[model samples]
Target chain A: MNLAFAEIQETIRMVQMESLDIRTVTMGINLRDCADSDFEKMNTRVFEKITSYAAKLKETAEQVEKEYGIPIINKRISITPIAEILGNATVEQAVELAKTLDRAAKELGVDFIGGYSALVHKGITKGDQTLLDALPEALSTTERVCASISVATTRTGINMDAVRQMGEIIKKASELTKDRNGIACAKLVVFCNPVEDNPFMAGAFHGSGEGEAVINVGVSGPGVVLNALKRHPDADLGQVADVIKKTAFKITRAGELLGRIVAERLEVPFGIMDLSLAPTNAMNDSVAEILEEIGLERVGTHGTIAALALMNDAVKKGGAMASSYVGGLSGAFIPVSEDNGMIRGIMDDALTLSKLEAMTCVCSVGLDMIALTGEVSAATLSAMIADEAAIGMINKKTTAVRVIPVPGKKEGEMVEFGGLLGRAPVMGVNPFSSDRFVSRGGRIPAPLQSLIN
Target chain B: MSQKRAVVSVIGKDQVGIIAKVTTILADNHINVLDISQTILQDFFTMMMLVDVSELEDLEELQTAFDKVSNELGLKINIQLEEIFQSMHRV
Candidate 1:
């Protein structure tokens, strides 16, 4: 046999017991050529383009899952930002385009379709403004469409105007879907320095720089990492880091193999593999659990940031070694709702918004999947975006805020978002107002770090 | 066509005619067994077989056949592509 018996058993154990699986195999289809002056014509082109490219996506993924005996959780499609294809189109047309995307997603049998998005990190164009205005209605009416907006980047300072508008848009989206515990807001993400080829949602989008179409895979295995750490209960921190690196290398190699096969079958170019430790609501499958295993009393305690920083760096090192192309927020994710350990930390009062914000400075994403009180003002939400954007801008990293302000829900109350989104307790925000700060709506002026060139 | 292979592993308690039952199914499907290794660890029967699946038409069909035998013998039988193990364990 080419492989050792122990290695085969270990692989089986990871799949059967440790919840190891490829998170997503997202196909990025460029819709730039789908733009047309006529509203109906553009929508028709958009629908046809997406459906034709993604017709075999789910079937191919299912075949690979069976052949390899490794589950590929989500087979999704991301396209060119709709705002780019909505040249001079009306807000109603933008909403119509979103409906076309949603209809195509349903026809293709995929769960979620991302890239109902706009990039206005520098300034909002007419088309971008149209997409922003249509977000609430677009999100409310659609089932599988996910939206993302980039309001800041390192080179371009924060667009306070877009941030404030997104705050209002999020509130309205929640109000529109208040019957479902504000579920529409869960499908939306506000990003600072968002990546173009991210295979994760609700932030995945086929960026402008990408080619016609490509396949990107996101690998997840927090449970595998946790199990590896449990074997060495008494190992020092350095040894602990080495264990995580080795485990991550194996996970990334498996992901690359699966991704390359999928891309080859689909006849699309293989883009990148995202080695993200994305956690799930399942027990022991959490980045927070990994942190706790690293000698922390809980995930959001005093030493949480240091533990996350070390783990994040080690994961990157291992993944970079395993694959030549590693991109798309390749670090540990700490979404409160999606992670059982994070939810427990929040319930136990060990984790708070402040700690999550602080931890994002050392991790991949920022302030993800947190539900806040209904009374939380839009200015406060904008202020939160500003804070997270500042962290990303200063550190030259990707940060995002996907907060749901559930209508009629108070602090300490819980909102259930069902599958994947899970449930989140409504957290209390600072009572102090950012009304004046956000009201002075202009550019925040790119920091001195932007002048590095 | 180039050669393609897979690893079929069966793990459970040692049972009568376990090897015969599995190899019969492989031979029925025209899958040639290239290598076989079997052991008993702590009163559990574990077997690993490398087979040339290049002549096999559908992997799922063979899996369903194995599923029936697996249920009859009360063993966990899984067949996976050789590439998965090679990619993870090597380099």
Candidate 2:
């Protein structure tokens, strides 16, 4: 046989048994051309442009999935951040534009349409303020629209004013969607050092520097990594890292091939492949499980940070060698609700908000998909965002917070968002207040590392 | 056009006419079987066939035919483009 038996069998096992699959193939379409002074004309242009460009996205992804015999789980679209073209629109017009985006997403048959975003790392413009004001309404009213705000970056300090506003916006969104356990907040993310080409939703947007249209793919294979580690029980930590690297190489190669084919068929440039080990709600498909397989009894316990740091580095090392262009948040993800092992850890009291915050320092993203109590003050939420932004700013890595404060839910209780958002136990936050600190609204100065020439 | 190749794999309890059944479908679809390898590990029969699908259209149709054969013969049959394996296993 041209291919070794073990190689063929390994691929089969990875797909069939382990939950190896492409998480998303996001097409970033520049909507700057769709901008117009007239609100109705702008909406029409935006809708038409997205529909025309992404009309074949779903069909092409399905065709590729059938041909490769691998699942492309999500076909999504990311546009130029809405705030960019909002110009002088009012908050009501911004919400209407979000509805148009939601309509475009539905027309294209994509589950989520990202880029309802605003970048306010340094300061907020009129458009940014309008979008921020419209978020609570736009997110609650729209089904498929995902929003993100970049509140901090290494080059520009954390925007404390925006962070404080976001905390209140999150609370209002939760209250608006109180019936659905704050599902709207699940569709919103606050980012620090956000990537323009990230294929994952709620944090994905086509930056100003991106092309007219590009294809970015996110590959997921925590189960594949977990199974590889399981096969080598006695290997030392160094050898274990080797196993993860080899597995990641294979996963990234498959992702690049798939992304390139999709891009070619669509006749667009292949942007990048985000080799994030994004976990799902499925059993045996958890990044926490990989950490535990590395000898941690439970995630969020002591030594979890070291284990995650090792796994994240090895994945990057392996994936970097396989793909020529690796960008976005390309490391391990530790979203509690989306990962079953993490949900279990939360239920067992082994995982807490503090531990997850620490884990974010080493992992790809931060404090992702966690649920907190409704009574938790907006000040506390803002403080949480500040802490995470600090980590991302100082370390010069991307981090984000996508916490859902389920109304009427408290710690140790479960809030179910269903589907990929999964269900997470409401985690306890510090009862102490950071009201005075966050209330003093001003930008935290950029770290000295940003002074690099 | 260059040859479009695929790998068809079948695994199940050792049984009769497994090769005949799978090859019959391939032959009907005008797919050329370039190579074949089979082995019985314990009581399970595992077979792999590399075939050229250049002339074939509608891969889903061929997959459906294989699925029917799979259900009838009590074996698991999967047909995937050969490039998937090569890209992952090779440099």
Candidate 3:
């Protein structure tokens, strides 16, 4: 009711020229009830439930986009983690289930369907073990299915067994799709303390605690924030933070409005609006560039973490103010492949794997969309996952790893994932191996932070 | 009842008859202009019109109508629901 007339043109300019967008409107549909002892029946039930529930998802999103004049970039679906429903499932049955999910997603016009996943942070169940065993093949054969695993949490600590196995799983998945630059690994993420209702792909899933079906929205606008910063180039850090907060507020508001309308139209409960500053490969839509605009010459140079932390905090504060429900990994996403500036940072030797690991401590997600040399050992991958998990567990924040080891690819070579997945130059990992350490497959006990209760 | 309104924004090089042409199209679609403002900054023109689209029978038609004006005048015109601006910039 209090919309100012003066703000109209500015908002339009943000959309038209600054690349502001509702990054994704993901429908999280619980598939737990679709399970059955008969695998074929179970698959059919899963397909029917998803197709019926999300039949109108793309149409409604397009209608909303046309009505509001805001681009709803991706309309996707997340389901209840398949492992939870596939107890006593065989490896072949698990693969079939993944294919079912992929087929259902394609039928519903959804780009990606997540939750081909398992949660084994504390211990692996029979279903989780089977799903993990089949994950590599399941992901390679399916075109639209994504898989995620949670192997650590603050309360229970890191599960070294699952961590070590994921290293091998990623290797096999990468080998299976070596023809496509190991794109299969791009659809998989390993997490410590994964969120219940994230709307972002390769990580989103319908948490067991969620209701029958829900709609979650992810809003992204690094360009909007950059434009705000450019307006006050002479402003101090405090003023810079203020500008980012204000810009985030406006972006989150638009996302919330779009989410509510889409949910209402679909007759699904509105989940949460994730206000992460996700970037694409396009120019001027990069989070690393936003960091550089904040007085840093290079993204991985000194003071980069401090600048990133400030921007992440400001984005959350501003986004939290705009939406009543703010959840998911709501901060700045620094995926190297998905963001052009991050790619440039690597190409210029301004960023490295070690520095990216350090930056994950302050950002939303961890070590996302990073490709390493083909010869990097599985134990090293496990060690990397352990490091990121330790950061998340100690800080009690959500952190994940989506690293791909492209076969026959080395540093200084480009791997093109195409579309929103973008492309990246293979970054070198440390030459030293963590084999002996990773081979000790035992739990890393929870830190003192877990004793908060 | 809540009023259904939309903000129709236009931006391009400064030219004659912009307002007249835009208003004529809105009138053709039975849209009533609630408020409007225009300004010129260094040969560039920008205009914002808050109009009641409650009587709008077809959103697609209205969009095509605006597209026709935009194509003919070499301007970028956008029609967005008022709730978007209210939710974004306002508390």
Candidate 4:
């Protein structure tokens, strides 16, 4: 490939100045064969399988990084959902399994290990119920383990019972980790129409249909898009979309190459690339900044949703043009704590929880990394999940809730999670209770969009 | 076939011996320069070199040599494998 010098300079500038990097290269390891009647035996098998499969993950990723000069920020592992392996397990046993997964992650030197999860969109099985009951203990006791529960799907609709249960779980998780500013809640996510091949946490899992092992890459480059937009400040909205699409294509192509290299070295199958504009706390590298680049005075203002819709759609279009197999929640992520612009928007009173919810209608992830008041009732939290699930279920998009209820913290207080998780200001929540609505336990039927099949 | 190539980029204030010093390091390592271009963007000099590194066995050694030159010249020098550029910019 005889790439032009200008193109080479542009790619270098994107990396050196614009924070373009491979956000994650998550290896999906299927642990279905590790299940056994004895939990101890199963744990041993799980450890052996993971350590053997990912033994060279960190080293290979570093080698590739040094060779290509591309920063691969995270090396992670996503296993098959633990609930599938823990059939009829007690809550104590489930927590022990979560610890095993955590130990494997620590030993392998990966950042995070996902798949402490249960799918209850249709209904909760025995294994799903046990995992749900033990989510608080599991999350609080582990450092690197992430837990997700899919409470709604396009076909099965919303499971209000699971949604209601999740609210209590989130509260308990926050309370258990209260000393750490309710950080355990950051590891748990409530999802609607969750994808199986997502490389990003806290919602990634190996999925039932995946092979024995696969490698998925998540690409992040919001700063590149913002810089491109700044170069053409006078361009109209249509031209703005064109710029975003081109930038996203480049980002996706780089991500696909990285994923292929990692997978080839590990001798694993190459999985999909997630083209999400995942933001870090770093200045200028934020999805919210990209929104502001589109001429919005603030990220949560009146025209924010329309701006986000254009950006998200253009990103998908561009990524599709570059890669043959693009999957996961591939769009702009608006996680409040992880985005400096979003945090500033909230601090300036320009962004609020309700406005964030409205913005999620056009974005990829929903209510991500948001902090809420401790006094927010479990019923209200459940109602928030239900509303987000309704949006995902009706619109046929992936949406999730990773809201943290910082215990003993009121509005205007900040919850510092440190590092890439970042710090979040505790935003005010609606005081009115939704106890009666959530108490009516049943599934919300799928909408008309689900009838396309 | 796409030959294995590397791109050596240098950027800093326009000064003497920027290209000479970088190309010398490349030449000593048995790496062949395929294409070279430089432009001064209002006193900030930028040069990009596409070099074939098929003969170079140890990548780290070349990197260390470049690092030394970067320190001596006080310029930001980066050597990236060409696949990164090709993949990012080409279909």
Candidate 5:
């Protein structure tokens, strides 16, 4: 009896040419242990603990890569919000801590350290207030440090108080380091149910219920899926979905296998797998291309959003079926520079920040990969962050920005990140200011309808 | 009679002496071809053969016999355990 096999390479079984490897396998290290009454001791603990716990991340990632042949792009550390840890310290001390955290990440070869953050969703706690106050300086001075502030939630509604204050804080953050602040705000995400085990950046922090030194892998492959779709351009939606589902299964298997090996070697519990379709700056890398191929002529058209909703939902469904513990922003990422199509489209007026915002409701992260003028003020920066957080809190999704205000550049200019580092063209900003409105510092109380309900 | 019957299929382009080359090896191993069907679908040739392997003295010897036919003819072949095939295609 003969059992025969068909040649897969021959029958157009979708060849993935430029697949995006998992960008970051971030290990979120909660730093509640850094809490101390003595300010100096607290600072030392924050630096020492984060550095010590995260020390093995790069080495572990390299070993895992060697064994599995999967390249881990970033080895990152996320911690308990620094504001909470720096409660007893002065603003200057907080900035120093920012520097120290940035230094620690650099020393460990970690790309960026997150959890320079705060949560004022309910009300501004004393520690949260301290971090908020020191944000402008803390962010301005640090090199490889990133920060986020969640000023609203569905349960708590919008914190008009924190929101207004953040307008000033963001304005200050932008003004102090106007060039980087725009880009920095993009990395810093404000969210509703900000997941703890998120292995992505600035918004990615060690939320409360996580293990000590676990490895969480965030697998991103929009480039692979997009290329697959291109091959089956004539296939019906069902056929397209089947192709995506099968492809996701194989890609996910790669991540799971690598994560298990890393966890075993490190002798720690493996964390949840993040299967977000993170894009890069490659020519074919884009969520827009998929949407464009689906129907729309360009990404930001009126029909663009509906197409995005379909693509994002389809991706989530396919990814969810493939992996058991599917968490993080497990949807399509519409980041600008990361997707070369988006970058070109935005420059040519095919996409706008407002249109990007509309699509964010259906997609995963909000206002990601956006670039603005370096001259843009922090108040506007905060206003922009607040606007995105408003979307996340209302919709109960993880929306974020990697808004880069390219230093010294005006609108229609680009800031380049060499290699997988994407380049973003600075888009025009809302000339209007919410300084007076944002100055009104009272918490935008929870939606009134919800309270009665 | 062999205790169980398994079906093996070979599909490809048929050429001169393809069946002689395949059936000769089966005969040499005493693997009596129980029933056989052959068809040409367009340019491609296909064949399904039922063999009584349960009585075969050695499964490896029968397999080696089929392997030789496969190497010479460039045929696509599938040999399936009856139960395994049934379980895969169960109602």
Candidate 6:
């Protein structure tokens, strides 16, 4: 509070200019009430609950912004899993529900809507089974519809049975809507210990225990933090970390203020401020930029793991200082299309799925925003998912896979999503096969009680 | 109304009456101290406070008020935007 040193207004201006503003303020709405045995009642009730609950989300976020002068970018809503609501309903009914939610989001003017999902982490319950079966048609037909399947867990291990099922599921999902650039699967995610209240998606869904309404804000500034680090190139690790810790603190503050404001206006409980550096297609703030600052020219390399570990730790450390509740996968995201620098790394042949997976072990979300070739087998895709789930289960972190199998395209080809669904140059897959392993069509026994160590 | 908390750190030589003088200024301005801690390393004295001033307009007001305390106590003071304070809970 030394007024003589620098004006408080100057400090505020410094924070405003240096920090990246919030990426999104998401209201996680539990749609358990949407469940109904009757198909039509289920659909109508489902539509009404989500549409009404989220209608004010974006507007309220904007209001909070103008009132506080803190910019909260996206106003999104994540609902309960679609399969849970589609009880006793046909797959067509599920697809119809998907369309209804999509229309609701469109009406609300939200950039994206999450929660067209199913979770099979422990085991695929009847509801999860139905959701799995309904995903292909539901995703193919609906534009804003996103889907997720968690067929593995730390306690229950990998569901080879569900994995085999999803292998076929993903193939059908890809083949059915190749024209939408196989965009349906792109909106889908595969997860482990998937948080119900996650504000980011195509995998966001209100957890079973979440309040009827809760607001979570995801504050991202990997690009901003990366830029700050760039300013101190030759500094030692401690100094660089000091810079990151400080940047995360300011960003989290902005997000905390926004979350409280949005939740108050929406009349929902403010959940927590997620300090995840949710990278976008923006140039300077991408995860690749952060990695580049860590001495790697690209994200896929030998030192990538160390760079990611340092970044993930520093973000959590810094963000933790700024909020009472800092949750979600609070680390760097290496999504392909959504991050322009990551996309460039892919196009330049400097990035690959293996390296992405390796980096995910040290990150919050594993192998997200990745695009695969259309020719991949459901079995191989399942194997790829199994690979990621293994990492998540072992690390006990929230990890997800959002793969876009660009329809009718081969590896090395790039497909343009047009709009925020940015373009991706299809990545090559490992030639080696996992058919025998994946086709076992049963659960892999849980890992040792003690870690592999 | 939005309220921001700051962790004010006073680091300098460990001299007599450091706490007595700093507390006087804060109390004079009616800025209630939510929490405080002190530590000594070698001849240096470090004191930190978690103070809430939703009652005040801006940090400048707090800084202007704290200058009287800092000058008399000969302490280097930093008002950290307390959201940046180390998280007490671990995940």
| Each model's lDDT | 0.93, 0.93, 0.92, 0.91, 0.69, 0.75
DockQ of candidate 6, scored on C-alphas against the true complex (2 decimals): 0.03
lDDT of 5: 0.69
* Per-candidate TM-score against the hidden true structure: 0.98, 0.98, 0.98, 0.97, 0.76, 0.81
Report how far residue A152 has shifted in candidate 4, in Å.
Answer: 0.5
Residue A411 in candidate 6, Cα distance off native in Å:
2.4
lDDT of 1 by residue, A172-258 (tens): 999999999888998899999999999999999999999999999999999999999999999999999999999999999999999
Output the worst ten-in-a-row residue range by lDDT, candidate 1 chain A. A444-453
Worst 10 residues of 2 chain A by lDDT: A444-453
DockQ for every model, please: 0.80, 0.80, 0.65, 0.65, 0.04, 0.03
Model 2 TM-score is 0.98
The true-structure Cα RMSD of candidate 5 reads: 10.1
lDDT (10s digit) by residue, model 4, range A304-353: 88999999999999999888889988998999999999999999999988
Candidate 5 lDDT score at position A53: 78
**Candidate 6's error at A207, in angstroms?**
0.3
Residue-wise lDDT of candidate 2 within A1-453, one digit each (tens)?
Answer: 679988888898899889899999999999999888888899999999999999999999999998888999999999999999999999999999999999999888999999999999999999999999999999999999999999999999999999999999999999999999989999999999999999998899999999999999999999999999999999999999999999999999999999999999999999999999999888899999999999989888999999999999999999999999999889998888899999888888888788888999999999999998989888988999999999999999999999999899988898889888899899879989999999999999988964554
**Fnat for candidate 5 (0 to 1):** 0.02
Q: Give the per-residue Cα lDDT of candidate 1 at A64.
A: 92
Q: How much lDDT does candidate 2 score?
A: 0.93
For model 2, state the Cα shift of residue A291 in Å. Answer: 0.6
Better of 2 and 4 by TM-score: 2
Complex DockQ, candidate 2:
0.80
Cα deviation at A235, candidate 1, in Å, is: 1.1
Residue clash pairs of candidate 4: none
lDDT: worst 10-residue window of model 5 chain A: A7-16
Poorly placed runs, candidate 5 (over 4 Å):
A1-16, A178-187, A374-382, A406-408, A417-421, A448-453, B1-91
- lDDT (10s digit) by residue, model 6, range A239-263: 8778888877767766776688678
